[model samples]
Target: MKSLKLISSAIAMLMCFVSMAQERTITGTVTDQSNVPLPGVQINIKGTKNYAQTNYDGNYSIQAKTGDALIFSFIGMDSQTIKVKSSSVINVALKESSNQLQEVVVVGYGESTSDYSTRSYDRAERKKAKTAATASVALQGKVAGVQVQNNAVYNPSQNVVIRGAASVSPKNEPMYIIDGVPAKANQMSKINPNDIKDLKVLKDAAATSIYGNKASNGVVVISTKNELYKNLTEQELDKKLNIMPIPSEPTQEDYDSFVENAFESPRTAPLSTFSIDVDNASYTNIRRFLNNGQQVPKDAVRVEEMVNFFKYTYPQPKNEHPFSINTELNDSPWNSKNQILKIGLQGKNIPTEDLPASNLVFLIDVSGSMSDANKLPLLKQSLKILVNELRQKDKVAIVVYAGAAGMVLPPTNGDEKQTIINALDQLQSGGSTAGGAGIELAYKIASENFIKGGNNRVILATDGDFNVGSSSNSDMEKLIEEKRKTGVFLTCLGYGMGNYKDSKLETLSDKGNGNYAYIDNIQEANRFLGKEFKGSMFAIAKDVKIQIEFNPKQVQAYRLIGYENRKLRPEDFKNDAIDAGELGSGHTVTALYEIIPTGVKSDYLAEQPDDLKYTKTETNSNNYSDELATIKFRYKKPDGDKSIEMVQVIENKAVALEKASDDMKFSSAVAWFGLKLRDSKLVSNKSSEDIKKLAKEGLSNDADGYKAEFIRLVEAVK
Candidate 1:
């Protein structure tokens, strides 16, 4: 009788535990100390991979068992842990952390980045740490498990060991991941110390286990601030580096006509495809307009171009591909019912010494229209800097055209620098514009001196006024298309302003498989010719295109943020013969999409359609699935024929705007400004004050002072 009673009691206790184990969704709101809804708060069920971030309004619904603990964490906020009881709705209020935790590490890969217990060195502590310039410079007592012993003599890095390698063959240095790419010991010495943000040495197995065998010797993960904020403009870099432009009253300039794209329904058009655009001429042109205290014309603002103007330091690719891919999804700041999808592609940067030899042809338009000081004079100075950068093996040929095209200098070796400069200086401008002849002659000269497996290109410097034969935009495009087949690339450098044919030059560069840059002054020329030389010469990937497919079950309506001119038909994605923009070394491309998730009732999306009588209605595979969309990209090696594809699927990860990184927040501010310039309905209500505030907070390590310049621009506009 005692055994039966005991067994019955145990069975009742098991049933009670099972009753509480039923899985159910827990809806909640996350707030800050002041009761403000914290955006981007990451909430996850502890001891499990299930996680969700709080949306813009601090509302989040995630699946969890009644007995599980939920973790609520953000960057600067103190994390809160709570266990689920009978209540299905859990609201959490997290206080700000008085002391900064080491949570700013770049932890991707679906990992719960909210938690890192290891001690880390912030900017303050890093300023105190000292190391000699020699090999004996090791963190012996500084770090817990790391012991650096450099010989005062030979092999300086030989004694630097992290955790004393488990098995050593004399090469057990800790893996150094600088800016997302693994660096060899010799390469580590070259890294700029100013670029680093946080330095953390992962010595424990718990910290190093994430890297597997790569971490056997331990790991040194150094994170750098975004690249977009690091690049300095020409005028900013050197106040005296600009060409002196004669002060003339601001004149109106005409831009190519274009229309803003409209929102599209996923039910009718499920695929959004477009060619990648890296051109930033529009942004600089607008800046030029502003500098002259002139009102920018609405038509001159190309949102996509403006967004791509600044660099965004995305991660470098670790795979065989030449470019890295990164994406972020969040609620749109301007629209409550919409979400913003950000996609970034960064091309690998090739060092100047490693870049291939070049065969360059300078196509100068010495036409009568190019007589301005900012036009022909600036062009000559720019070419001189490029000539100085050429290697001994490189060759250059100069071709000029006014009434007719003719070669000013034959195929001259890069060593004969003075000869090239003399030829360039002798050139004079005073005839009818024959741009067609110039292009044809330039291509011929470039082709004649082409170097196999090398950088072969023609740099066209012009005011974009072509009045002779084949001057029509379509005709010039066709001519460029034919010449590009010869494996010769083009780079169009626009000069002057009023009467500048921006449309014609843009077309020529696009069809000729090249890049377009508008050099308004001498400082701008230095930026192109001196600082960004290799990036302009060496092509890494060509014909890069992006195709996004949003799950109809998750998304209701979507609109691409920009790239109105680069939009292509869905079928063109697979066609290899279709020419697209080329990605030069160290180039970064970014694209944004405004998406509306399903179940969120909004006036922007189309009405739900009834079941069709002629066909079966599409059904959701899983109504409650968290998948939002899948983005795929296709890119070809600079000289390869076949294209490679990479795909990434995004979850419904919505974080508060405050939780986003400075890279995301600042880029969004730039995108928001573009919309403001266009007067788009999307961000119409987003005031200049809101954008400036966000941008101020988004300034990370503005070491190069670009972010400061941008903030000044914002204040000027306001």
Candidate 2:
């Protein structure tokens, strides 16, 4: 019996050793010599079928055992081989190959000969093309480095390698420009190969050079005979696509255009009414543009968002109201002759533990457009971070939309984090974007499992490339408007770059009484979803509106910076039927107004029109000359429809620009940068250097380091 026990112990010990030798998941990032993330870098386990490719953020996870050799390869970069050691994390920075120039042609357009390797498959030649479901499959072996893996009759996947892998993006997928507009490679899955007029694959760098970094992997130009009209203008194309623009890359991304606000005479328009904005999508989107070495779009530069992106040191609300208002008047940094008035609102902060129970629905887009590594993959990672912050009382449901909308995870307690994460992991991207359908299903789930008087919200994550049912901006706006009455708020989190639809997402969030943010990287995910969980998930006030009554005695004319889209009719301020912005717990909102002092001469102020016929202008009888502006605001409780009014008066006082608080200086610098980006005629001759100087002055004890990042962004402008 003793001998038998010893034998059993030996067997158990051997089993443990064998288990330890089995494949384990290893994760790491790949970058270039300059520490820039390299997407599409191919990583493989030597002598094994296990492999993984880096996502848009240069991150990857693979199944490999200890002591196994891993090979990393990308075109134009030196190959690297590393053996797994004790650590599961392996990071590699590849160096450019010395003989890369000989192998790769420089990508440029308008060259003398335009002699770069190019292949064209005209309609006549492709008449007998294989009847494949996807464009990639149809092109099969015709194009070099393009291979189709037929796993099953129903699941045939294609992988296109254009002159090997390029680390320009997170994935090795080439940019697909359909007609004159740029699109994602996976979008071609929806197009019929028979409808293709001319399919040309540009393999040389010179042919793809026009697209800059977006074409690092290569460029595939597709022309559809029946679908697209040749030589359509940008406006016509945008109208035809029915998509909003997300400006960054020179792509089909759309943005709403608006002329700059002209100086308004307090005498003509006494009440300046508008909604308070808390969304910061514009700022981060602009940052992506600057980081990618592209010009920032003028319409994309929303000054209010840029100013509010950084955290401010405003005092917490101490009254019955959910927020506290503070105002400061200082000399305008750009126009020395004019004064800049800063209005700030600080929402009451609530501790995470004391926050109410949350019934959160994650509305994720798993469409073909979201197939980019930065889109679906990054979104999953971001949501996981939020899951970690959930408390036991909090519940989460996941609703995904592709060709249709469906619920993936039921309402599960936040404590069941592993289960939620597992569901997220199983999600794959394909099919058209039925964004409107997705929103309907998400709202249904939220309403069914409604947590009365608790934090009920739907967080929509997508690139906003909606093409299927109810996808247009007007349709989405009307849909969200109806849903906002359900007392369930919405939050739009935008991801990806090329072919991003910022306008649609903006409309959904704006009408749904929610906030919007653009998640550019994992760090931004941490900032928006993790670090700002209390503020992002819990709303202190809803339908918040601001109406400023300028004092004609102390001010001549003033123009509110940004908030152009949020402008409300003078009578809309009191109407409870109209929707406005929301204020979250611990959130801070800042607005700047360029004011021309009563006697100050300014070029921005157009010649005052002659007195209106048969109209008499009446001045305030309250004799409040000591006040520069009377600010009246209204807000409703998160669950209430009625708004409570509050009023504050800005004293007619001016402080030197140097005497302003750090927040004032930093926010001003950001506003200046925004105006500069927009090429506004209001700004005096100011260089980026001047803005950088002002930002550095306000770089006082920035714990989050956001202020420092702002300074760096300004430096990247030129």
Candidate 3:
């Protein structure tokens, strides 16, 4: 009987493993009965929060387990439900429904062709608003995450901004569509509340991407009960909507251009110096591009950021320092002849209750460009998550900027949770951005409420589109550089797309002695703000710099991956005035270097220069032939100014790729994938399949499922 029980337990364990492995990626296209692609079709996995929408090409990819049900829905189209089976691809064809065709309208992109509507209010629901003073007021309780702000003292008109929908313009107000004719926010109240038959709101990028720049603040489609337009056909509706074309605006998204690091002879340049980067924005931003079926721009693929996003098993610091250093050597997966070196830093983890008090100032951008669901709205949600994680000893203040900057809330104790949330909820996006003014005021507030030895920081959340006073990148950089001298660090949380200015945010974080992250979705907010609150909120070390000297005796040529923007002169490593990146509590940073051993012959090597006729090259004679490289780290305490240094030596031995640790393998895979994305000459022949296979080999300790997600992203690339 005991043996029988043991056999049953073994079978149960196998079943559990099978169930965990059953969750796989599902990809397909949504089309109409005529074989025309239907973009913005909302696909939801039944009984779960997992949801996705078709891109411009009507393509989508989602994750689900076997036997899961997926519901495909669109406006004016019959919704269909399908059960997941063994197949990974599920194409759906939605049929048009005449019954509800005239009752509602769906608008996407600029294609007059209706595809989907996220939220709608029919006549029955509209009746609830009949008692309200205006149509905008009626939508107060009807729409989710929608707020109607009325500055009665200044303006009588209600400023309606959707907190659930994201936009990328200075016009924070929603665009009004009256019977297919576009109208302005002021005209929203002019329309009689009783004349509306149906009202729908489009908030997601998939639904709004086609609407162009004018709709960046979101679009509200309304169908009036006018008998004159009651019997109009879909073609007539298109004609009426096309009366005014979407405003033409060039894409203002900005990313700094950088050339890949080229291999350098150790004999000529032995030291590689750079700041330690803790920012993981590039990885999440890259995932956003892949998930949307868009080609990632080469500038967006920061190899160091990608490799450092995941956590590794580095031991904690037992010494007086705030972080631990680790190193590993292994065969390069992409190039068999070359070797790869991994350097990792693990910041000491401190429990939230035990950490020092925090003095945080939420410097939010409520400009017109931040009106989108993902911008101001998502920003609010992300902040609320952090608020819940705050302790009573911590303190927070709120400052906002648009046309001007001012404090909305004074320094309040973290225990007043609801009060802080109420202030965040009341914020409305409008006017052009004055990021410089915002920074000035935020730093002032942080300094006033300084918690001597606590974590004092200004959290700036925005799309980085500063357009009003002092909006130039140079102006912002100088402003931030001055603010850092106050000993109050900065943290930039970027949101939205299209007009996103990554270059500006990066500069602010780098010069202000802080970290930067891009929040793409609510899930990302939870990941960066909720699960990793300690690391994202508190800092343990500041001005962290790394310098490594490769011995020519064991290494021929070497190149550091990424960090093109963070590189520093060898002399700057010891300069206390020189600013660098910060290491947050419990945060981990990883950097990789591709090295060519002394005997290896490769194409990457440049032609040798004239044999240096006057200078004879010297080889290491210190009897340290087994040492491949010596690395040095410099960092200052969170509140201290002077820097301390640490050193570690990497052995010359290289382990086989298959025998390397999961972290070494995973980091190598990430670096290779980043190189592949950038189309780097070093990895020109490497394919996506190669990245996927390498990533799979590093999935042993992925309890958080991030490693598995990385593999799926690799496979998603076309």
Candidate 4:
């Protein structure tokens, strides 16, 4: 009987292992209505991490247990989840997204379409760079272990040093890759301010080793925004809603969206806090409209983004913290009676050579929606520019999605330029868009090839016309939010126009620990991929937040200029779990406030009620000084989960607008432009001529010709 009991126990244990390991291989093909196989589709067991990527032929085999649900998904197609009973075969046929779109056409690689909307093609925000308007300023002083040196406000190049130079090469510069292609340090400086999204800095041996011998220096990665920026309505652009635009038209759903932000009261709500918003898409989109001779929309103009888009030339940071604090109080250009309190944060700059290795996935959308020459073709050329700047050690994988998603290239060394280029050339546009599946597969590829402390990212380039399954902005956003937890970052690049869904793209980029850029042409792409690669590709600091407490004794009412969307609750400033914008190496950020002195009377100020019947009014403490306000912010190292604190105090003394530095005047001019564009009640008396004159006068240190460009854009509006 004892022997029988022992045998029974053994049998029980054996059965347990069998049940625990009840895994079976499920094979299937994902396809569209045309019966064409889909590649790179994502197949996985529901509620499990076990997932598989389809091969080039759209064939997939995934492991799952009996009764477990298997999910199959494509980007623009409906997703299918099947429960495993006994059958191992699970074929899926995905159709186009049923959600309506405004005739977004996709042509083959070789064809040129007769689209009438080509003449008005346009589209796309982020971190404040230093004294300079460029992104490098924002990245400075942010990294804990890295040393950054900022150039003059106008100088775009920054010196970066990583993990104590173990070994050095000729230039001792780390290679940079933006969106999976190699790039030069200076190329990072040229990207459009609004086009940028996130930066990835790779350091240490484990991360650097992947880049081969060259990585002995380090590597920086840049991700651009692929989401929509702005699109004109068909009736508004072509005088006929019946004649749809080339890309897409804003739908009734989009037009029906409502958003509003009210002014704050200094009497009761004296303290103001918000997440820093570097997204400047509003400014550029305004330029496109004006250049096309179209009237600007009030809802589209974000005052904070427009003002923050220009550089303010504040003093660079000198302490252990990432950004330097610079404050200036001056009379407002729009309202001389009001005081303009300017606060500038200059993130320490790090030279490019000192950065780390990288692991990158180039996720390109080849869906029929991206068939325009400005979309797919332009995307290819832009990626080529980035590839040319790569080091032999960097690794890149190409993932494309359309009617279905697929991996056209595995992890190939950067030096294998021919192979990479050939793979790019072979890509063609057709079929429904499987954006969800594409993101899943691309991230899967990135995670699989991820290096423990390296720059791991997926650069997603698309036209923002997701329609198929799980294509809702919320669904795709949740998907990216979940994936970013795995230590992978995203860069979204928006291409083409019309069908562009700016809200969808911006949300995806924001949630994915990445940045967004609208690539209207190769010039913008080169600026992002070639010139500003360092600042564009690598992040030096993350989760940076700011809070300000005004002296109600010295100020009665105040308003922030451009960051309406970045407002945060005071408590959120201390919560490390709340993610904020990132600062790139040498990146700079600037903010402006229009304040009404305590003695001045302004209609915008809140009416003070007689001492409440239930309680006495509170009096100000420590009110005897000339201090204007106290500014405090929190930041964290790139990979850290916690944030560090930083505080700064300002004076109440005001300077004349003319007496202020050129940085102030230029940014102020941009602010007025934004206000005028929005028809803000605050700037009713201001005119475009005033803005143009001030912008021209403030064009000091115009080394990069950007100031000149601004002047031209302003003039075009006339």
Candidate 5:
């Protein structure tokens, strides 16, 4: 009887073991680079519907047989497929997808591959072009859809447009992105083009969709390069040397000579021949001020006005890098006791050892529409400034479109400033506009002189009129879109008034993957071309995008300040190949958000019921410790094969706005400015005066004239 009982027990034990072996339970955890558990991860069999989702702890368990394949997938992460070759338990450490996370762009309502879309010039071409042109002049005629219009003179703020304008308002310019952040349009001039690596324009719906309603105009994505400090070793850092170049000063003799010469020259000129009354007035004034023979105050020469009007060379930033400053005292032509001051300010020397050569073409409009004093004349003046600043290695070409397109000047060395200036001086206005033909000719010239690893850009200046060949807006747009494939960039500058074609200009710039700007005056020109040259020309990042995930428990509602046109969908922020914006060197972008805390006691909303119908019955367990939002940024290097970056945001307890950092304060001020401009009803109890005060407090020590100008503009507008 004992033997029979033992046999039964053995049979039962064997059956239990067989059942357990047939269906084994496997459990494991998944984590990210920070070693933090990733919840809501999807786990499925290689070829079956059997799947399980990870919990908050990133832990998952499933019943499966040995030799099965387990697939793990998550948003903004690459998928992982693991084969169950041995043990039942599996743990996964997912490496973030560099391309997937960094290159994705928000095209209108959809998404596309940003990697495939080629603009006027590629990375190699831009590098080569950078070598040929001065750092300030790096981005001429290189982009297709962009239209760069040089104010016939050396004015800094040339007209820049993206994919043409779609609105009737004067503020139809495309949005600007700097270092993966959206900046105010007027502030675009603050960026230094020389520090940029690449520029990308989001023109078509496919490229601007992520921004939804605000993107109807267009979008620009800028990305800055990583600081070199990341790879520096402690010893190497300690050994780092700083060098600053000091210019020699003029001798006392030189100063005295200049003053003597200045005292001897005549200061006044005859009044305009057309001004009959001015002639009599001048005589009366001369006689009245003679003081028995005091020279009639130099006959009201307007010398001071003229002198003040001219942009005098100002001291540039002195740094250990390549930047330097120089000043000189010249012999004055009209004064004796007072010396004539001449300042020769120099910027950092950009070595061309690894820089690219460039082939640039200027597509100008010599049509009647551009006859405004602020139009053609201003353009001529602006171009002259650029011409004088060109380096020997750069080549420039001129193409005018009016009734027909013609090449006024073939590719020539930038050193021939006089020849270029003469050509600009001789241009005349007549006939209708032929923007299409002009664009074609400009592209052809740029391509003909194409230098490998150089920048090739076509700058178009116009009133956005294309009344001649392929005049239809759509036709011109298609042509630009196709021409961009040839690796050429386009920069559009809008001119004239009343009939200004903001829409067309916006389109050209956006599709060309370049930047756009509006030139309201000469000061604006200097700001664009002179002060922000580095940021305006070189692009360090392209197709950049930003997305923030707000934690519901920590915040009730949040509104992004500015960048109404740059907001992107959560999913579209990860797709590469979607055309975005470009970030220039040394450009700093700021953004702000006003959040309404969940537990705050306020009457901003309508009365609520005591008994909440859909409210949660349980309060958040760790509300104090949870984050409010996660800010994510993605960007590509000027010549890099992919994109990368880090993200940080505020999440702990809600801090008062008054206690925010300096960056936050400046960003909030900018937001206030945008709200005032747009007259947004969503703005809190903030005024322009309040914004100016906040901005003054947070102004950077290195602020050039931007802060002062901001304050002045605020007062003027108010």
Candidate 6:
């Protein structure tokens, strides 16, 4: 009897194994019509909680009985139900719901449908139908509040912005995130649009709060394509992947041709029409001629004329990469009182993947003023270390601007290390700073040997002394501005202690469409060149600008802090030709504002005079009852023919600040820091300690020292 019972049990077990094998499993990716993989898509058995989250790759795998029903549901997509009949592999495409917000929108850490907004775009439903190849093209005018400006120039790195201007601070631009990492917004344009699977803008306070102070401006989230093939086998992944930089360097022949073309003036008149003498001694003589009440000729060495005369030497192109230039306009928002017009410009996009090839023009200020060890001598040693890292393709051109600018070396290649080192060794300190003359000569050399696509930039290492002839800040600015049009980017590397002229260096860099970095030591130089070289060279977007219209009803009063020079007039929004700030690849700009609701019990402002001209209109008590504010932005591509792109955000009830995404929290902390840095009068019940705590909590997976440095900076100021 026992043997018979055991035999029956064994047979039952065998039958169960067969049934399990027959059940089968269906697994695949879910994408929208545009072929963009959809994440957070709900997948479950009908009428059951047996659902799974879409992995980062927008793929899902599940076990199902032969006839079990599987349902797919997404925020803006129509629900899809399929029966697990026979096939073990299944791929699904979802159509957007026509009556509802048909497109799934990515917020900071969540997804939402356009149905939540009254002014959502109708054609967003078709975004998924197109492939990633044409994502930016498809985005032309389809997304409400989203703009894609194309440059007349055909270049890949297009400038993009989210929600218009929110502040007039130095870095009052939106934040950019890649794979959940807070990257620099300027760097995003360098990334191939094809490499991106999805890109979303976080506008309103609700969406941006995850980024906190930084979110006050807005946030852009870019999900790359690599995340989609997470589950594929190594072989399959290899077959589906082709990751390579699009060639951007020009050839040697191309460089020679360009040089030949440049030398041949198109004008029938003499080349003297565009030429001017700007040597330091000549400039000083001209100034002396003027100061002595002597008549100066039209051909006299004026500051502008002198600065424009010298040729700048860019590195010769070793590859097929094209050199580029970018610029931005600095104006107040439509409703502000500041009127300091400014423009920022940058040139070239040096690829980091290539060997360390750079034509570094060191504009050192060795005037009597730079007699300190931390000044001229320190500058020399600091630059020497940078030279040590160069490869054969790299080269260094030393231009000392003190009472005059002169090229220390014509164009020494990196391979001739000893020659370059010897030139540095032979340098000496003397004379006043003929900053104007030095700048002109440096640019002259840079332009003369202009590298077709190599990393050609003028690194101005100085203590900010421009005390010689035509040394005024404005004169220097004008000189840099005119030269920037010629495509030689500039980087102001500030050194020394007192009278550093931080503001002047900042302006030179801004006008030159480059960056200004304060280097107090070797570590700082390494951080700028060694660690952050990619951010320093590759400009993804130029002239990036943002504008925000606050719904008077939602926000009673608001104040933007820090950008005393970048505010734009309301009318500038309609003008697409204006120059603005540029964004480097992976560079992020953050802005902040402290807002006060209408009914909130806070001392925002003193009672205004009833007869005040601008306050004559009755204050609308009904405005802030249901709305907060709206944000808008406008920007141009690095090489686009025209400006394109606009984004908007409407404020909503505040969520749990702690529950906000890392972006929102970190952004807010940044805003707080900015406010403290400027000593903004708008801090509402917030303290420096609070900001620090919030920043610590929102710190993302920051392996680099960026966030930590910010935290430290904030603490130091406190």
Best by lDDT: 2
lDDT score at residue 141, model 2, on the 0-100 scale = 40
For 142-192, candidate 3 gives per-residue lDDT tens digits of 456565644231233466766644332112567777667666565565455
lDDT of each: 0.73, 0.81, 0.80, 0.67, 0.51, 0.52
- How high a TM-score does candidate 1 get? 0.64
lDDT per residue (tens digit) for residues 77-184 in model 5? 567888775586799987654332123233344334333211111112111122111211222233444433322222233334454544422234566665555554
Off-target runs (Cα >4 Å) in candidate 3 are 1-250
Clashes of 6: 94
Best by TM-score: 2
TM-score of each: 0.64, 0.72, 0.69, 0.64, 0.48, 0.47
- The candidate with the higher lDDT, 1 or 5, is 1
TM-score of 4: 0.64
Candidate 6 local lDDT, residue 564: 35
lDDT tens string, model 6, 532-618?
A: 566555555555665655454444455544343445555665476555665554343444444444444445444533555553344
Of models 1 and 2, which has the larger lDDT? 2
Off by over 4 Å in 1: 1-252, 606-624
RMSD of 2: 11.6
lDDT of 5 at 235: 39
